[model samples]
Target: MSFALKYRPSNFKDLLGQEVLVRVLHNAFNLKKIPESILLTGTSGVGKTTAARIISMCLNCTFGPTSDPCNTCQNCTSIKNFNHPDVIEIDAASNTSIEDVKVILENSRYMPISSKFKVYIIDEVHMLSNSAFNALLKVLEEPAPYVKFILATTEVKKIPVTIISRCQRFDFRRIPTDKLVNHLKVIAKKENVSFDEESIKLIAYNADGSIRNALSLLEQAAIYSNKTLSEKITKEMLGYVSRYTLLEIIEPLVIGNTVEAINKFEEACNSYNPIIILDNMLQIIYEICYFSITKKDPSIFNDNIITHVKNEKILSPTFLSRIWQVLFKGIQEVKSSSCIKQTANMLIIRLCYLSSLPSPKQIIDKIQGNTKTDNNRKALLELLKSNNMQDLYNQIYESDLEVTNYNNGTLNIKTNQVLPKDFHRNLLNFFYNLTNKTWNISIDQNFDISKSSNSCYNKSLDPTVCNILQEFDGAKVINIENIKKEQ
Candidate 1:
């Protein structure tokens, strides 16, 4: 038997992860208040079907209707093998017609042949057609007391809400990596498979919380490595980048060496996935930031890499954020690009060059600091473009909009250009969601830019000019300069 089937949870007590589901079902069955219908939803291999089988065992155990069913009982054994006559299991993906549902409903009306309750376990219930759902809905609405339905699906959203409303729902959680690691350890010990801790962890990480996938990967690893699993063999089998190679690639990335980074990345590329390379880079960024904030090094990384991190001091939140955003974007590019190597190399070059570029705040500050040019408009334009609002960027840039004041989440602007309908409302909404703060944005048609600090009309600090402007009404200061020193 495969490891997945051999190690599958037989009872709620053995089920890993999903404490809430087990607790609720245990209480329900113990209280003799088991719902006539149940809906189990989660990603595959998180034990939705296993839970359904356990529920069957709970209902059919010869002792009584109990949460803890005896595995030795005939009914429990039959349900474990999915051959129980009273507990019928069908994959709705294959049998998804109204006629099929009608037959099941017809059978549901009859008393159990050998058990107290007749159970119908439908897997992938979302695949049922509208007509089939309608037919099943009518029966589920008024189920017979002797009948129980256990519906399992990965895509609960695809199922009708009405159907969901009729059943007790349990959303299963993915097994955490630590839990998966421990489970794999137990399985390996049982099979007498020699393995290392890192190898098991690599399997669990690659499994992405799917217990079945982890077991399958472990089983394959054991066979391919001659019943002995090492980190090297696991990396080769799973097409994962090695710890050494991961650090080697990240060193160049951190130091902003475009050529070396791309060279290291291409050299490491073999049967492994390019996406995993990006994921490794992201992991490095995460570790670096974690170290910078906590002053403690992660054990997974060697001292060599830690020395590299401290020497470069590249783990500042600003620089790390820059690398993180680019690599996160590169993962998708490699996934969609026709040539993974080319796209990845290009991404590496971008990352190396991107580190030297000024951040958005620095760029805005530099623009605003320039006294000769009218920079307020350019600063606002930069903000729009940086946020990827191309439409707003174009409108403001092309129309020659004048921004007079910007401070304390209030944007004061002077513009005569025609804007699209609901422009202010949409802009406010976007800024609010982005900043999580209410913003005051007002456009003026006839504002005096001459008195503003960020405006192009240069204002003076001369006492006479300041007094004249303050005393007079609607007075403008036009390019006052060469004032006396404060000494």
Candidate 2:
């Protein structure tokens, strides 16, 4: 038997990381107020089906309707061995037709031959067809007093609302990584296997909150290590890069050394899968981001990770976010591409290039200088000229304006002309896109253009001529010289 099945939780106390479900089940049994229909929903391998079986044992125990079941009791043994005549287990995925549900409903009507209650445990109940759900709804709406239905599904959304409303729903949460690791330790001791703490943690991390997956990985690692689990063996077995090697790869990236980064990546590719390497880098990036936000290192990672994170100077939250975006996009490309290694190499090059780019704050500081409003106006004009935004430039150049405020991301301009509806919006968007800063552009229209120095020319020149000059730079009308060939 697989380790997952062999170590399945047989009672509420044996279950891990599902306190709410256990509490509710214990209370229901204590009050003898168990619901006729119950729904268990969560991700795969989080023990929904196992909990259903345990509930069956508790309900049909010899002592009757108790929170705890006696393993030696005939009812408990029968249920555990899948031999109980009254306890039915169904896979809704394979039997999704209405006819299959009809059979269940017909059987539910009969009284239990021996047990105190007739229990039905349906796995993947969300796979039931629409008509099957309707049929099941009728049975759930008015179930027999002796009949109990425990429906388990990974996808609660697929179940019909009518059926969901008729049943008591319990959402099972994923087991925490620490809890999973500690549980694995106990299992390792019971199995008389030697394992390293880091190896156990790696297994738990790979399990992604699923106890069954953790156990399965543990079993595989034990077999591969000949009953002794070490970090090296586990890393090799899982095709994962070592933490030191991962740190080595990221060191070059953090330092913005493209050549060194690519060289380290090539070396890592020699021993590790591209996907695994990228995933580890992503994990490191996530940890760095967490550290930046919380000012505390993630506990699951080792001291080496903390030291590496502390040593890197470029891993601010914004810089780390940019790296994450690039890596995330690269992961998708690697997964879909025909040449994984080549694509990964390209991704590494891309990340190295991104590392050299200035962070959002740095760019903003460069654009909007450290001084005040006058500097900001000069910077804005320079940015417009560099980007060749002639229309906006002309508007700013021709307008009679004064800067009122420019600190803390707000750009206030006092202008005379009635600006276009999108003018303020466009200016704000332009500055935001350029510097990654949120600019609040407020236009003050109280200033009179008639009092300005060029007011006479502005009033005398035709609006069309002024517009043409503004739109076209250095435009001139040379005197027309009519040179004609001899006719």
Candidate 3:
């Protein structure tokens, strides 16, 4: 038997991660207050059908309506084996019609052949058609005391509220990670299989909280590794991408190394699934941005991710956000495309291209740098004015000079007047003494000040003026262009 079927929970105590459902049902059965109809709802493989079967055994066991049922008893064994005349199991997905529901309603009226209660366990009950639901509703409203209904569905939204009102509802939760790992460990020990804990954790992580998925993955890994589940073999067998592999792929792409990124992706695709690769890439992007914003360590382990994230260049919100968007969109395209490899290669190219592109902040600053340049200009004037260099300060401040270049302590001044001899050299020395920063000062005597950088006087209007204009409908700021535009 497959591990899924072999390790299926047979009783309330055996069920994991659903304390409320188990406790409620256990109490009800022990007190003999079992509801006529029970509704179990949750995601698949979380023990809805299994719980339904266990309920049947609990009610019909020879020990009679107890919280715990003896598996050796004929009633419990028959129910477990799914061959009991009193216990009926139906796949509602296949039998979702009024006629099928009518047959069940008709059969439910008759007394049990041997057991005390007749149990009907319907799986995927939400798939029943509207007419079928309406038919089932009447029976649920007035179910016979000897007849019990246990309906299970992944989609509780599809169930009618009227039908839901009549049944006692229990929502089962997904099995937790620690519990799943322990469960898998117990199974491996029972089977006399040698396995590492990391291999079991990998299976659990990929299972997405589904116990059945975890067990099935373990089964595949065990067979592939010959009952010895090593982390390396399990990762290869499952085609799961690790954090380290993701770091390798992302580091190149973030650094704008298109060729290296593509080569790494090609290598990864040979081993891992394309979707898993995309998912891991997206996860890395998210983690980097998260750590950048929160200023927290990405992980406890000193793995490749920690070192890669410490690069600081790729930790920018601009890079991480852009790459995340490109990779996220690429995932959808790859899913639809017949040639995933080609599409994925294009995705890598697009990612590197985006990385090379300037950030909005960088572009805006390069264009104007208005706010930053004003600070430098103000500081230079303050130094010249306060240090008793009245003649030079007046010459500079009073002259019709145009700043052709002002970058990082370098200043090039052009004026429509003759400069004093050794003025540039003296100013450089004085500027260094004032700020302790070496400067490159150049001048073009007898030059027009018209061809110069932006005028500090022609400032843009308050940004909120536009906001105020937009806030009130039909509000207009007349001659808006003339207000902002200077020829």
TM-score, per-candidate, Cα-based:
0.70, 0.74, 0.70
Q: In model 2, which runs have C-alpha deviations exceeding 4 angstroms? A: 254-257, 309-313, 356-487
Model 2 pairs whose backbones collide: none
Error of 1 at 272 (Å): 3.5
Q: Please list the C-alpha lDDT of all candidates, in the order they appear.
A: 0.82, 0.84, 0.82
Q: Write the per-residue lDDT of candidate 3 for residues 234-257, one digit (tens) a residue.
A: 888977788878888888888888
Q: Per-prediction count of colliding residue pairs?
A: 0, 0, 0
Q: Which candidate ranks first by TM-score, i.e. highest?
A: 2
In model 3, pairs of residues that clash are none
Report model 2's TM-score to 2 decimal places.
0.74
lDDT of 1 by residue, 388-454 (tens): 9876676666654677776669887776433555668867887798799999999775434344332
Count clashing pairs, candidate 2: 0
lDDT at position 106, candidate 2: 94
The alpha-carbon root-mean-square deviation between model 3 and the true structure, to one decimal in Å, is: 11.6
Pairs in clash, predicted candidate 1? none
RMSD of 2: 11.4
